[model samples]
Target: MGRTVRVIAALGLAVLPGTTAHAAAQAARPPRAVAPALTAPAAPALRRSAWTGTWEAAPSGTAPALPGAAIRNVVHLSTGGNAVRVRLSNRLGTAPLRLGAVTVALRRAAGPDAAPGTLRTATFHGAPTITVAPGRDLLTDPVPLPVRAGADLLVTVHTPDDDGPATFHRQAMQTSYVARSGAGAAQDESGAAYTATTGSWYYVTGVDVRGSATGSVAAFGDSLTDGVGATTDADRRWPDRLAEHLRVRRVGVLNAGISGNRLLRDGTGPSGLSRLDADALDRAGVRVLVVFEGINDIINTPGPTATALTDAYRTLVARAHARGIPVVGVTLTPYRGHRLFDAAREALRQQVNTFIRTGGAFDAVADADAALRDPADPQRLLPGYDQGDHLHFNDTGLLAVADTVGRVLDHRFVGRAAGVRVLR
Candidate 1:
């Protein structure tokens, strides 16, 4: 008789063709298999911390004292974030600066007080008050205040001590409120306490926010970048416009422009070279630099030579590159009709612009000259864009410059944000 064949199936079962005993024996036997070990999922990569400068003004020097008063500064934010911090500068103060209290809030349409229920107090190292030494800057503790892009923020500071010669940004463009001689106005919600208005920003230099932006672009220049001719309280400065344009992307714009600032020597403020660290590289999350200066050095008192200007440009580029920040050079706009402009100055401007355009020293170029120059006379600004003084740009001209810069930055950064970090 043929022996009955039994086969073990892949399902751990024994198949018996003709014997019931085999089936019973297979069913009685225990299976010899072990369960596979499970592993904890790999830890997720740590999220990088990024700080974007939502609003900024280059500190020039001290303004009239705000002795024992509460000052409310209205600032326009370029980008929004989940949290916020304020940067107060005593960079030009001759005495110790005492901040009794500081608060930040979202404004309600040009008003002195913040929007109802949006006020948040700021602290330093967990303290409600802090003192900043002369020539120093202090950053407040992060406040959980969600902000929107292009929103207005009111930063109110109460100084109980005599803040002699208040360190300030002379051309704020936006109006701020001062409670001449009062405290606790910072916590006022009705704006009834604020009585005086001023165009300059005192003590407060920058507003930074914790964000996910790829980086920030520092606009380094002079009066033009400072929005000299732009309409007051309009936020029409070229850098402001550029910041508005960049709202959709992951970038921030910091205007480090000081009126009458020079590139090689001190004038209205510290020279561009001297302040580069504090104004550009040291700013939180700065990844790209836009150099629109040197025009003052070429046209103002003690004007520098074209060679000197270009050499400075080279140095600026080198310095930025050393920090892995790409530098973009903006060609100087025309100034043929200004009192300081002459054939020699115009020639020097052309030479410096040529170097900016073709020198290959900068990572990129923004042809602001071509964008604002009159078609009929390339050496002069277009009448429609000029602010009557050929040296400065009106609202329309500022918009044009902003558009050109936006295009350049968008092309180089928006879609290729990863590449921006890799730029040397």
Candidate 2:
């Protein structure tokens, strides 16, 4: 039974111990010992949350920008911890990228309908000045950033020099910026601070919030997952959309995608098989994972035999399962044109899809093929959803993907809530 206590502020009468006298008994007995005062529990100690998120920028050498394109999409991360670490990327840049200044701050919301709050103040985890070579990424030093989860974390970067096309994602999933008033504006103002000004290269790659070592989700995949053709400044990629979904559910989504990334040999970007440690398996407290990849492996150059590709996928599955993380296999979407389609590629794709769908290795499967494929011609991608390359999905198409996955995930979340399932 639980304990209960009641306090009386003022009582005029008190029952007598022996007789029924009230006033006489009140002045007779010794006063009872006053109880000790209660105090509130202490706040949790400052600690970094294992930050895991991906880079979002428009990659150059693509078609025109889509609707809602911007200079950057700033993601005010849910902060919690003593120190913070930021991951910046030039993964899609064609040349070297430079940074004028970078900073983090406490954000202030302009209004309820507006973005999160503006930066009340900030601190740097490393030198404000840094540079990233083309096709590379940078991780900032562990800076003391005392914050709690659900708090806003503002990051800003400026590029004075850039070369090549200055690689960027088409539509990013998270928010990033190109700088307007240095890197420390009280609020991220509307309108880009920088124009499409000619320069060497500039882009924000990744950011993480570390608060105690726990809970992370790897946003694993290829160009689509990498936000290849999303939009400059506008973080509207599928993975970002997925991240948004996860955010509502209070789950962390770490994007581990590299543009043109394949599950087999190096193709558009890094291969998935080789980057597992750095991408997914290495993060702390990562309890769940989503593997939405293998399209490039099935369709890219120097194509592998069906047997080889099958073997590669099986290996990836085994590796993931070995770590005890529940892996959700996402089917490779339809890619029938834009120059990379072939009979051999089709065979490999089919074999890989078969494995993804039927393989008992995966904890669950996300059928992107069904979501994006044409109902009339299931093998071909649905019209309007395709980015016209037959390889990637447009923003609408990406949203469709997230919606489908979210639909599937809904059941899992509901089951867990109902005590029918458990995620450990």
Candidate 3:
């Protein structure tokens, strides 16, 4: 038997300042499950305020499973809290994924060393060990710890036996460690046992913290949002930069980007339309959704038209509004020298960007194209920001994109989102 794991990417769209971009047509597909505009969920329980997303890496694809081997994923946080919890998924597994041990702790330095007195074992349903069924998600009970935002945390997982494909997020950009022995060393705080290193995040999907921040912002899109061009372990992805800006305000940012992903169909993980809820809308304390994608859709084979892409944006926005979560759209940036660049595709990109800016589909707009494009030639990426790939941005380019996003989701936007409604 076989299963298909959808690769979801972000759409390159934008919202006008306190105004809606209007598009009248069946451009967008029929609302699968559209949410009302500017509505947040009703009065909530303690759990509602108990957890806010600090970090995330959307599962991009599966890899061969490693039984009896322990995996330690080094992750960075956007915000910290009093208590923390981890979420693991087997959504793409063909068989049950067994956990022998799981641990979370603050990092002492870089490598795999855990800070003293901070290592904590994770439990599911009060049990230290449990089986995560295929196509399912499980959350570890919250551990009481002082989690500092902008810090690194080590989430280590050990499997006693191989089950099926290992659900993982590729392009972690950060290095992780693996222990080949049955000891897994998952319970060890020392780095000596973890002799091997890997670039992808395994099993572990998200990290959430309780207290400190009231809500978070989800950065949804493609490789640009995923930090493809950023330095390893530097946390300089545009989303990471945005998180730094939001830190002072106590807001978290989640980066959910799938490289080579598209908005209309699955290529890397799941299509853009299929991942909105998991990547953004449904996340803990998610108040805003910002998207920057669609280059793949335009440059890839048999790409989507401006109309098709815009309709998809409208559908995504409608669903977000129904849940009372405000959507912020970002225009696509320039990519002139890329291998896939072409005149027709470039024209399509421009058309889609126009709709994103003036189509009345979003609540706020960030002109990423204008911010990162060369004034001498609007079609080309600014020389300072180019990651050398023309398509992706370097650290400087990442910062530029971050500035564009922050300019729109500024204090005024944050204030309005807070009072508009609670997210459902």
Give the per-residue lDDT of model 1 (tens digit) for 1-424: 2224333232222221212232233222332221111211111121235677777887887787777788899998887888999988877787878888899999987779789999988987677787676666667878999888888999998889776778899988889998966577888876888889988998898888885654677999999999999999999999999988877664678999999898877668777876776677667777678999988888877778887787777777766665666777899999988899898888999899988888777767899999999999998999999999888999999999999988877666445444433111
Best by TM-score: 3
lDDT of 3: 0.80
- Overall lDDT per candidate, in order of appearance: 0.78, 0.52, 0.80
TM-score per candidate: 0.86, 0.63, 0.88
Give model 1 RMSD, 1 decimal: 22.3
Task: Give candidate 1's whole-model lDDT.
Answer: 0.78
For every model shown, the clashing-pair count is 0, 45, 29
What TM-score, to 2 decimals, does candidate 3 have? 0.88
Summed over model 1, clashes come to 0
Please list all clashing residue pairs in model 1, or write none if there are none.
Answer: none
Per-residue lDDT value at 175 in model 2: 39
- The predicted structure with the larger TM-score, 2 or 3, is 3
